[model samples]
Target: MKMVKLICVLATLLLPHLAQANPIRIKDLVEFDGVRSNDLVGYGLVVGLNGTGDGLRNSPFTEDILGNILERLGVNVTGEQFRPNNVAAVLVTGALPPFARTGSSLDVTVSAIGDASSLLGGTLIMTPLKAADGDIYAVAQGTIIAGGASAAGDGAAVIQGVPTAGVIPSGATIEREVAFDFSGLSTVRLALRTPDFTTAERIERAINAAFSRHVAVMLDAGTVELDIHATQMRSPAHALGRVENIMVEPERRARVVVDQRSGTIVMGEDVRISRVAVSQGNLTLRIQEAPLVSQPNPFAEGETVVVPRTDVDIIEEPGIGLAEVNGGTSLSEVVAGLNALGVAPRDMIDILKSIKASGALHAEFIVR
Candidate 1:
C-alpha cells in the first residue's frame, strides 16, 4: 500500500510536465501493411491532335503500331498506303490499388512521349493498360482536358503547364482484379515513416495504454507489432477501420531546414543553440566604363581616335555585432537571439549556417 501511495504521489508531481504536451491517440503515427497501391502503365495513341502528332518518318514505331492496330480491326493496307495528321502516341499510367475490381474507374494520366507539339483537344482511344506482369488490367478512353495552352508564331513559342500531360479522374475502367485476402492474417504491423526509438516506444505505450492491455508491442525502431485479440476486432476491415481513426501525436526531431533556391528557412520549436558568437559581413563589387573621343588636333591631319576609360571598386560591408546566442532555454530567448542580428531573413540563412558550423547550433541542419 505504501509503494502504491508513493507511485500515486509521483504521478501527481509529474502532472505539470504532462500538461504541456500530453500523449495523444495512437492511430496517426503508423501505416498498416499490405495497404498500398500498385502501378499500371501502357502505351497508347491519342487521336484528333490538330496537326501536331509525331511525324511518321521520325517515329517509324508509331506508324508500325498504327498499321498493326488497323490490321487487327479488319482494315488491311497490303499494297496501299495511309497517313494521318491526327494521332499522337501517348503513355497512359494509373494506380491499381489492392482489391481493385472490374467496372471500377481509376484516374489515368496521359503524357505525350513523342515529339508531338501539343496534346490539347485530343481524344484518347481505347488503350489497354497492363500491370508489371504484362497482364491487361484496364482500358482507358476519354477526351483529355489539358491543364494549359500552347501557341507558336514565326520565331517565338509560348507554353504553359504542359498541355501534353493530363489527368482523367475516374476515366479508366478496370478489366481485371488483383488478388488480396485481408482476413487471413493473425497479426498486422504498423510502420512509422521517420523511425525514432523514443517515438516508437511512446507509440507502443500509447497503444497498449489505450486498449488497457499489452496488445501492442514495440519490435524495432521502424515497426510496432499488434496482437489481434481483444484489442483488435475479429474482422480485418473493422480492425483497420478502428486503427486509422485514432489520432496519434507525431514526434519530430529538432531540426532546421533551409531551402537555398527559394530562400526559405524553417526551424522547429525545440531548436536550440549553445553559447557562441556570430558575425556576418557582405562584400559588394562595382564597375564603371566610359568611352572618350580624341579628335584630330585642329585639322592638323591627325587621325581621329577614341580612348576607353574604366573604374572598378570593391567595398566591404560592415559586420554585424558579435552577438552571443545561448542555449535556447525558452522560446523567447531563441527569438531574441535571432532578432538581435538585425539581418534580412534572407541574409539570416548565411548567418545561421555560420553559427551552426562554429559548433553553436544545438539542432540538426538540413539544406535543400
Candidate 2:
C-alpha cells in the first residue's frame, strides 16, 4: 500500500515533464516526394553446397538453368542426363536506393525456391536483377553467407535459425542509374509517415520559420508542399537540405495497443479514462478419475471386478468487488488507477475492453 502511494506521488510530480512533446527532425517524420527506393528481383542459382543442394529430379528447373549456364561457357549438355546435388535454384532480391549512380554496390538477399535442404557454403552465380519495368539494372554475384546451421544423425536432427536463406553484403553492382532530376524540380512535397493535421501544420510552420518566409504550405493532413524558388536556393536539393533538419514537435493520437499472444499492453501518454467501476475474478474446474478393483473374499472361486470412481469440483476464487477507478486527466494517473485494481496485465486487457464498451476509455483500443 505504501509503495503504491509512493509511485502515485512520483507520477504526479513528473506529470508536467511527461506532458511535454520533444522536438524531432523533419527528416525522421516525413519522406520526400520522388525520393524512394526501387525493388529489384531475379531468379538465380547457388552452387558448391556440401550435399545439401536440391535434387534435380524434384527441381528440374535447376537442371535446366545449370545446362544453360554451362552452355554459355561453351559446354553443351543438351542430350545428357545427369543429376547433381551441389546446386540449388534461388531468388535474389534487393533494393536500389534513390539517386544511386552507376557502378554503386548494393546488398542482396538469396532464398531457396526449391526442395534444397540447405544453402550452407554455397556461391551464387551471376544473376541479373530487374525492376518492375522489366529492365535489368544490376548484376548480383557473391558467396552466400547462410543464416543458420544444421546437423543430422540417422535417428534425429538438430537445426538452428534458417539455413536456406542468407544475405550478401555489397553483392550487387548497379549497371544503370534511375533517371531523376532532383535539381530541376520547382517544388517538393513532404509526405508524413503518420498523417496528422496538427503535425503537418507544425512542420509547415517550422519550415517557414527556418527561412523567415512563407515558403511551406500544408496541403493536407499528410502532405506539406515547399516552394524551392521562394527560398532563393539554387536548386530543390539545396532547399530540401535546409528544411529537412528543422525541428518540430509532432502530435500523436491517444492509443492503447494490446498484443493478445504476448499478453502485452502498451498505452500512449495521451490515453485517458473516465471514472468507472470494475470487477475481476477467475473460475477453475477440476476433474479426477480413480479406478477401484474388488476381489472375491478368500478367493472363493469368484472373478475379480473393477469399478470406476470420479471426482469433480468447481472453485471460484475471491476477486476485487465493485472497485471504483477515478477519472484520470493524465497518463500517470490513469496507470495508477488501473494498477489499484490489483489485476494481472492480461486481465487488465479484458477490463479495458469492457471499459471501452461502456464508453469510459477515452482513447482508441487496438488488439492484436
Best by lDDT: 2
RMSD each, Å: 8.7, 2.9
TM-score of 2: 0.92
User: How far out, in Å, is residue 70 in model 2?
Assistant: 1.0
lDDT, candidate 2, 1-368, per-residue tens: 34334545666777787777789999999999999999999999999999999999999999999999999999989899889899999999999999999999999999999999889899999999999999999999999999999999899999999999999999999999999988888899999999999999999999999999999999999999999999999888888989989999999899988887867777777889999999889999999999899899894988989998999999999988899999998878898998898876777788889999999999999999
Off by over 4 Å in 2: 1-17, 291-307
Please report the candidate that would top TM-score against the real structure: 2
Which consecutive 10 residues in model 1 have the weakest lDDT in total? 1-10
TM-score of 1: 0.87
lDDT of 1 by residue, 1-368 (tens): 23223323444455457447644555556778777788999888888889878887777677777887788899987666667777788899999977777899999999987788888889888899998889999999998888778999999999988887887778799998887787886778988878878888887777777678887788999898877765757676776676566656667687878887767666665678887887678899999988888897784987878899888999999978676766766444565667666776667778778888887887899999
lDDT, model 2, position 112: 99
Q: How close to the true structure is residue 120 of candidate 1, measured as C-alpha lDDT?
A: 85
lDDT against the true structure, each candidate: 0.77, 0.92
Error of 2 at 65 (Å): 1.0
